[model samples]
Target: MNRHRLRLVTFDAFGTLFRMREHPALTYQRIAQAHGLKVVSEPDRLKASFQDAYRKQGASNPVFGRLSQGSRPWWKSVVRNTLIGSGCPKADVDGALDPVFAELFDLYAQAAPYEVYPEVVPVLETLRTTVCEDKVPNGMGKGTKFWMGVVSNSDDRTEAILQSLGLAKYFDFVLTAYHFGSEKPGRGIFDEARLLARNCKAEECLHLGDDLERDYNGPKLIGWNSVLIRRNNDHPVPAGVATASSLKAAFADD
Candidate 1:
């Protein structure tokens, strides 16, 4: 193991830092009900269907893959597909797509849907000043520098979302899949983050995220250390990979 003390810490946005105050299924259900779609008996079934559709759309969308297309249209497609896949008949889903998209877009773009974790600020504050080595000679001149960043597979509204939640200032920079045109578990997003951390090498950059594949394995493929945050304790930690119940445990002194 290359035990280089990490200097720059990058995080995933959604699960790692901010969490949705309510399950997305609830929102989807509310929207469907408002638009006169038949309510399903089990909300989980609808939620699963919507998630499947969203994931498939995300994978197949060339706009996200190419990073050259506008995010609004891409999200519109996903939301529309979610409605269609949620057992809404095609005619009904089409009828409600426009309004649902408009509302959902605004819902997530603002802060009402999300909440920052209690330990996020303190953990970031500690890591930004405590871990990592000194400055790397910027023309501006600095005595020492440690960086905190965000790398997420989110839409363009991420920065605004962070700002709304008041988590923007703690980061040196934020990179979203919309900006890179690629999602996690792929090398493009992580590689872009590497370029941003010009002062630090891969070994010196540690990434913390909630997903095992995207947050942990993805960065590891690019030579960076990764920490998996199992906030719910739903899964067991795999050997040799770092795991934490919360963000605070991630950087807490042993």
Candidate 2:
């Protein structure tokens, strides 16, 4: 038994829980044909533009980042913005792309969301226990309702994606930064999560996530015991915080 007084556990979605795939290139040809754009026929160019805008904008704009999660921007939109910034004309840009938003949404629907790390289910299972005959997961102990939440930067579609992935049942409350209109490293979401956990002492709850700046720094600032799950640990270890090699170690014996 960990006996660590950890009543609630929180996680980050996207890179922390789920992985994203780029299948938008397949539909690029059709979108381009409809838009009368010949340059997008070059799948390589489309893929490059897609990835650039995707990663560059991630978590930088917070809300925009989350909504852009599953969607790839239109090649013309990408070109239009780049050209516009480079002093291209309004007519040149507007005529360069028609129905920009629709094209972006169509591109969004083509990609797939899957597990980030294969060990997630097993690790969560080891960390939590299923109660009663229906096998509903109640974290760690028997009879006591454990609090599980997600603090993420994601589109409004995040909940649907989680449900579609069959991961909706494992959590009690899920909070996305998109809904909150903020992102991690800001501490609003983390502060709210602590209040939601009903645990006044930071020592009583633990937070785990892949982003260090938002996941680690934000919670740690308010005295919550936090762990950096490989992706986030850029800072020198903070006082009173702990580290784990993996979540598997959190429930190894069970």
Candidate 3:
């Protein structure tokens, strides 16, 4: 890919730039234990229960319940349901859920629970400082006129998380589905990203993410360039899709 042609590069938040340091279920279990609520002994069971609750909550109250309810209440509901589904007594959960959810909320809002991928900083630096030889003649050799942003299907806490991880400085903007009213695998969020990048043309934008459908195919369907990062080799690369083992490899050509 020609770096000069791309004016904006957006990334997915979770599973791309950073990931949880440990399974969320472990964190939930730990918090529950602190609150004297004995959850299931097995972490996997709690994890499965959490996933189910999350999906159910999302379906009924999308965008972290931005419309019908608020994010805090929505999350509390998810936690409540997760704890109940994980076999915590409903009475015990009700008594401790507040503090438990509070701690979990604060834990996730900061960097304590997340680990930035090693290559993220270096790759972002390279992308941000890329110099276009062609632009030198136009008296623009100071740096490439490239912009970086994040477009994720998360709530507003994403910005705080990124800032706490020291990654917010690398981005010009961070657009979340909660605020933008659109999520990935849809054209709205990507278009909002383009608008945020000074209305850059679709073909002049690039996005990097982990999910094949949301990160790769979503952008491609709308004329934007995209690369799928498969850091773990978890899945097969589809025909004609740009694939990379990491962000470092994704832009190795650049």
State the number of backbone clashes in model 1: 1
Q: What TM-score against the true fold does each predicted structure earn?
A: 0.87, 0.64, 0.94
| lDDT value, candidate 3, whole model | 0.87
Q: Over the stretch 1-254, how does candidate 1's per-residue lDDT look in tens digits? A: 22225556789999999899887767877876787777563777767866886777666775343454577777777766766676678888788778887888888889999889999988767666653333343321233455678999887899999999888988889999877777898988777787787656787778899999999999998888888999998877678888888888876653
- Per-model C-alpha lDDT, please? 0.77, 0.58, 0.87
Evaluate residue 126 in candidate 1 and report its C-alpha lDDT on the 0 to 100 scale. Answer: 66
Residues 62-171, model 3: lDDT tens digits: 88987878789999999999889888889999999889999998889999999999999998888877755454332334456677899999987999999999999999
Q: Who is ahead in TM-score, 1 or 2?
A: 1
List model 2 lDDT by residue over 37-118, tens digit each: 4443345665665566555555354365444443234234443543333333557446745564466554443334354466
Off by over 4 Å in 1: 1-5, 62-69, 131-143
Worst 10 residues of 1 by lDDT: 132-141
Please report, as a residue range, the 10-residue window in candidate 2 with the lowest summed lDDT.
130-139
Could you tell me the TM-score of candidate 2? 0.64
Best by lDDT: 3
Predicted candidate 3: what Cα RMSD to the true structure? 2.3
